[model samples]
Target: MSLLLDTDNSAKPPVTTFGPDFPFDYDRWISHPAGLGRLPDDQLGQEVAVIGAGLAGIVAGHELMKLGFKPVIYESSRMGGRLRSEPFSGADGVFAELGGMRFPVSSTGLYHYIGQVGIETKPFPNPLDEATPSTLIDLESEQFYVEGAGHGALPPLLREVSEAWSGALEGGADFTALQDAVRKRDIPALKAIWNKLVPLWDERTFYDFVASSPSFAQKSFRHREVFGQVGFGTGGWDSDFPNSMLEILRVVVTAQDEGQRMMVGGAEQLPRRLWHLAPTTLAHWPAGTSLASLHAGAPRPGVTRIARDEAGGGIAITDRWGDTRRYKAAIVTCHSWLLTTHIDCDESLFSQKLWMALDRTRYMQSAKTFVMVDKPFWTERDETTGRYKMSMTLTDRITRGTYLFDNGPDKPSVICLSYSWMSDAMKVLPLDAERRVRLMLGALQKVYPGVDIASHIIGEPITVSWESDPNFLGAFKGALPGHYRYNRQMFCHFMQDSLPPAERGLFLAGDGVSFTPGWAEGAVQTALNTVWGVLHQFGGKTLAENPGPGDVFDAIAPVDLPA
Candidate 1:
């Protein structure tokens, strides 16, 4: 992970997710000793509806509960939402991360919670990462191997592609200056550089940025194609080619793609622990009280409808079983599209403009296939070749990226045979888990002609196409060109003082509502913003020393573009 070096002083701050948009210090705000805020005595123990038990809902509920408000969490699906980790049948702890897997160290907001939950993390084995034994890149029926760390280890073509990508970023996006400001947490400088780029790039696509760059323009078409297939950091970003350039820049500037780690057991543990953990420092409730204890060991059933409580002067949430509960305020942490397709929401809850933004929000599709192996056999070196049997593979085949996980010599290992996005993902959307595995195995066999991957398989393979799941609709938001207004509208929805009475009591919080989507840090940041909004609605204020996001929102709010 890169450190923020101070040119004048010796102290170096860690790079955090301090925004290029809002520029709020969420990590500092949450870590403050003074605590988030305090609720009015009358508002203590007042039930607040929190829809969706995902990381956002869980984080918001945990914080709100600490401040003496009773946050009733409603979950239609599992507790972790997209952080789903399905264990292999008959295995001790080996599982497949069907949702989010890799998390960057720069995601301080998320790390705070991961630390809170006491979950262990280790470096993820991305292609070309030091943590990986080796990486095999296969395209057009040709193979190249990268041993050890750094781009210099790659083959000539791949090294050229990597250098060209860097040059393109430097030439087109002022990469160094922007990342330096991000590393230093220079809010003013970050905003100045980023705000200018927003207007210039909001209407452009990531592909457009790459194609038009002087660096890439000088390179051959083959270089651009290879760059797309074996992109820097994680892997192939070609799926995001059509997305707004601003979306890609946000990830690059913040270093979201670097120094990634995976949860020890599963990403789901973070939210699950938060739900059951009874904070040592809490108000209005007993010392042993927990979110689980409040709801009798589980969250309330999935909410089917959300409408204004006309008589109660708040919001009313109706569960799938027809049980309706009223609350002084409500937070919606589910996918924005669900508000239109899954839930029956009141039309007057938001303005037509806000509705347009919500409707315009786009979600991306993703698919993953995994299997538990009998052992870490991939580590075994071939006698003749003097190379590991199977390396983490990235290709232009049906399986875009293949990842391997080694628990230990004694424990069973796991392999993500195929992790594809967009069109690649849709190819196996209708296929069963076994079929998906077969397809991926066939593709991998071409890359590793000698290795028998199926022989070591110990359990039934697990697969997920997030788009097929009604609860999720899609994997995560991928903003298109000209969708900045929609993102800003969702992101700033927490600051609702200027809104009409009907929209005041309801709020939105999740990665989709954040500038950096598909990252847990974004989910945590937005959840904190939701907490501040709920605290403010209940006449609560932060301590003088520790001001909340809502307290200083206007000053550092995201830049606005023409309507």
Candidate 2:
């Protein structure tokens, strides 16, 4: 057994049962103190073209270099991709996390790099958390405040909604069996149970499942409405009500969204650190060589086109400035939609089925706008009223989720005035930062009546409409009903050798290509899968003692229908 799985000998993962799969003990494999296997000496000088400088690209590049391959990366934007950290203009230590703020403890794959970079973390100040201080749930023209640690009981309707969901899952989904199998890391047991659920839930929407469940139907539709308002674990599920029920099951069963923490400085530190760190020795370069030094301190230009380098038995990629380069293999870590829209990728590179999967992919829309304040005003107690000045809020208004970040009472604080999704996000897409702030403020103002929110402002606000960002068409892929086949096709793309020659050298990877989308863990996991694919293409093999997830993929790959 791997030392990582031996601590307890109970088969229970370090985190909970809800994160994506960690079949290979990746954290231990990546830092094999004794070191991982090396590639053939003759392949040491060969270059691998890496597209995108995000977490996926950087991680893939770093690991490939450890095996002696030269990785030249290309990016249209700054490093970190959607894990963006916008530091306040004049204030140090304060930042607006425009993307991926909270990370679940189950994200062991992601944590391997985080720990390697020495990033500090604290439990996210989520609603009901001890660190939250207080929370205000405003909906249906009624507002209530819960004190620090969320000690008080919630409204009766909320409790009933929770009970109904628990009963429904327990009775209809064999919830206990699923959780136990996941906790045990018993892949066969998990498949034996989940395989039956795929066909049952694949064709059903989340709303359909909820409405048809005897537990939910036994209660009034009002309870259903309440359930939508205060969803299980996470906040409202109104935006996800139309998505596939299997997606919801995957999230809950894996417990992927709970017990989350935020990186102390910012999440971007992981990739930035990997960009410069040097190993004791490198395959092609001298000791102390790093990715930054390998690329002369910058990434190559954004990729504009990709095609088969047929005569060269490799793949050719063209940059935005029309600089064409060919390589023995390449890994594409960009959003899948970019293949058909922004880039002129050759049609023959992927089969018809893969193209259908890519074209049909549905990316969710998301919007977030942040403002800096002079202090953590929300934590301040109002003397006469015995109420907080403001509270971390979740509501039904335009702003569905509002978050607060405190550097310290003495320093500038960040207020994520609005963090909404789908239709709610689209409602604020057309507004500029100030206008979005005004809209969110107007909505929040009505809820708080007397709180002078604008008075504490320290600087201009930061906002993002992922749908409006050209580089990313949407926040992340949200698989819809009957989309399981498409997801399987994308997720299993690393098995490209089964496809025609045109599809062999160019591989796909990213959150969009993962079974669990919208999570950085998925991005890292899929990037590692592609690393294995590229390695095999170069005739390299994973270390026998530290095999990758792909090495055992046949037994653990997602359940799919016959061809």
Candidate 3:
């Protein structure tokens, strides 16, 4: 159960999942220092243990190693925790991303991480440019409206409205002027400026603020659809800027070009590559062993165990074997509700109290369906409108959150369609695997008729009903009214614990801590920040200081950039 090191040091070529076609030479990129074996025992003993192996955990470990701290990572499951990407064998071995899929170009840190690992990403195809003659349907009215190629039809006033707002927000205009407008409570003018400022509002819960918006009551725009687009930002609820919906929006628009790229094999290829990237720390170290009984801290050095705490820290993290692991410090890359149980904690360690009051937080419910057909059905359109690539349809009538995924490149083509109930405040349905797949296929058929549902479904569908998965008790996290204060406090406390000086012997890193969410960027950013916090604790400089040019955040402000 434990791995103890016998030799002074051992170096080996990194194992990789990528075949020869991969762009970077993994062998050349990762090197084991030749003289590392000569270091004294005291030097080697200066160790840090990271408890999770998801994106955040891996990044944290990589960063620590770079700083000369030999990081020992402990995880109950396989590495790449929530960044779990699996290939569906039924689709002619063509991969469908079961977990975290897309990344935005705006995530400079994530992009850099991809590069560091020597993995390549291409832009995800935009669904707006295709001509498959797709239309948003309104079931109530029995009406359907088609969008023209390139840009769809927009209300005359609304067109100018959106343009003006986007210009101001992305151009970096100050929000102080907009704050003045909101303070005055001028509804029309406020609506004009609201779009520009939503990015900064991540401090506020979307459900509360949007529900209270005058626009929501007046039906000024396709509010729910717009909200969904905005919400599906960088990483989702785990993002650091939990209240800033617009920052999420910005990640998507920017990544429209970059998100189009997929792995040469599929998303699953990346995780498989990560697994082979480093030798299992468990394999080489004698003192390093799997923990069986979960404790605040246990087993001296090599002994570790999984134990269930009556109260959950975040949703209890179920190990790879489906056992629960309690924690003093946790890297929560999973869904919010999974860990949001009303568990009491030591006041001194988790004084924020929000951890105990998670029942009050609101989360949106969503369903996703993936289908592999003998041929691509969406041949009607091309890369731009999702007719051929990815597309979204919004009309006066259609149900919201319905869309098609692009699975054109692989041998057995596939398409992913999704639907969500943004305003529905209901308990997530806990369905067994058989029932979950049945509902998913049923929903997909309702959205796209004439498509052969049974013929294309080569195997059982992979379903993630946030309601059932213990690791992710619900979908993503959402803020509630006045909950912003609690959010900030919770994150600050967690970040502080991650600091090397904190002596908590625990660390925190994940989607919940990054500045953006609903995507991989947030997780990666938080991971990077976790490293920075850890390094600062060990008397090391920030990532900017240690990683050279690849640093995501500069010590100098953007304003300091030379003209």
Candidate 4:
């Protein structure tokens, strides 16, 4: 069922990620004419070690450089971490989005950087989205075709499922009111509804909420099964069914799953551009100064160890080559699991409680297979039924969701043959790209018997199982039931004033540490928080006009549950 509430009022302010947890307007904070903030003169040229060259690290490094600090960025692998866009060999700039493809319009924090870098975006062709020509649903060998968008286009069973989901949200969580509060930026009301839900659902799973809700309980088991496979807004959330209900509510309430767009060229361009682009309005840096210039056009080697410098008064970072450097402050943008598994981090850097939270943080698995095609052959119409030859396919087979990317009419297009999560992802973990492609083609052959997807493919196929990557042990964080405290500890780590002296200068920022994990906006928001934390560490304060997240954190911090 459509979880989005019809609360759009043009006169009202647009809905942004103004938080159900920490309702700080990071978009406004960063976009303020006064700028993010100025650093103390003494700290202007001081180096800050930023680990990982992902979206969070690049954003933090970019902002820190603008504040006149020399941010030394360390990359373990590629530059754009999970915003990976790998180009097919011998293709004309066609990219297969390996990670972080769809971005919601409500993610103002992420868009701020996209706008800054002059990146372009178009509505992603999600299943049954207006941007998509048609959508095919295949469940239990039965196939259904939806020709358009909205609930009206869905089959009766699918529509009933959608309505039930909408009803469940309204009845259980006051969905309309909570979303209205979010759109209107009503902090009190937003907190009133969401804080109440946090305590209720933090200990429950998404599956539990769906099964027990009056709306779903009244329906047949098949209805719930369909909802899991062909979910509202996006395709198949069954993988997340075992996760905390709070996580699902956060996504629905903030519209993080709807009105999504895909970055043109590739999402990786955002970070790469931010690295090379010199902001016109920076504090201590000159006009031409950029992150690339400071780092001599490449980031430092991967970080091997992180510890407090006994000789110096701040954190010390060691590179893979055994080179060590000390920084007055440091920002770690890597996955939390990497802190324990990949990096030799000092045990004293964090309290036992915080360490427990980090060690216990859970991540989800994801896999995607993409192939460059000769043309937009899917656009061809079938003579018998007058339907598009192929469509955005959602199935329960090995290939859970298949997306089609039409570069243009004649130009080479791309198709994501299979996009699966959790168990589905693990099924092909040990397989190579060709084998995965073969299996996906076999599944699609059953759904579209008349068309041959294999014939249209050009260039080599690209596939990735993020769980297999050593640098990133999994796709992103997926908080489990009863893990609210762990999330709170990680999300609030950027506020270091109350932390012990040993952990004061070290900060964490990434999607994994955010309340809404698996979203670029979370990474952006947490990165902005890290920027504010670094400013505070240097004894700097934001201008009165633009008080940073730290300035008003106590008033709007997340609800703290009893230990």
* Per-residue accuracy of model 4 over 373-392 as CA lDDT, tens digit each: 99999999999989999999
List all candidate RMSDs to the true structure: 2.1, 3.8, 13.0, 1.2
Candidate 2: residue 484 lDDT (0-100): 88
For residues 1-563, write the lDDT of model 3, one tens digit per residue.
00011212124221121111011111222332321112233333245555556676666555455445555555544555445555566444555565556554434545555664468665443232232234343333343344542222533433333343333333432433333333343334544554434334544543434444443444444543343332221111222233444433333233322223454455545433543343323212333222221112321221133222336422223333444444333333333343434222233333335454334445544444455556555545544434422234332211233444445643466555443333321222555545644655564455545455566556555544544444444455545434444443333433353323322433445655432334555565455445545544444433222242113222211111111
lDDT of 1 by residue, 146-182 (tens): 7787755778888777777888787777877887788
Q: List pairs with backbone clashes in candidate 2.
A: 18-254, 18-255
| Candidate 3 or 1, higher TM-score | 1
* TM-score of each predicted structure versus truth: 0.97, 0.94, 0.61, 0.98
* Deviating ranges (above 4 Å) for candidate 1: 1-12
Off by over 4 Å in 4: 1-12
Alpha-carbon error at 158 in model 2, in Å?
1.5
Error of 1 at 27 (Å): 0.4
RMSD from true fold, candidate 3: 13.0
Q: Model 4 — TM-score against the truth?
A: 0.98
Top lDDT model: 4
Candidate 3 or 2, higher TM-score: 2
> Where is model 1 poorest over a 10-residue stretch in terms of lDDT?
1-10
Against the true structure, candidate 3 reaches a TM-score of 0.61
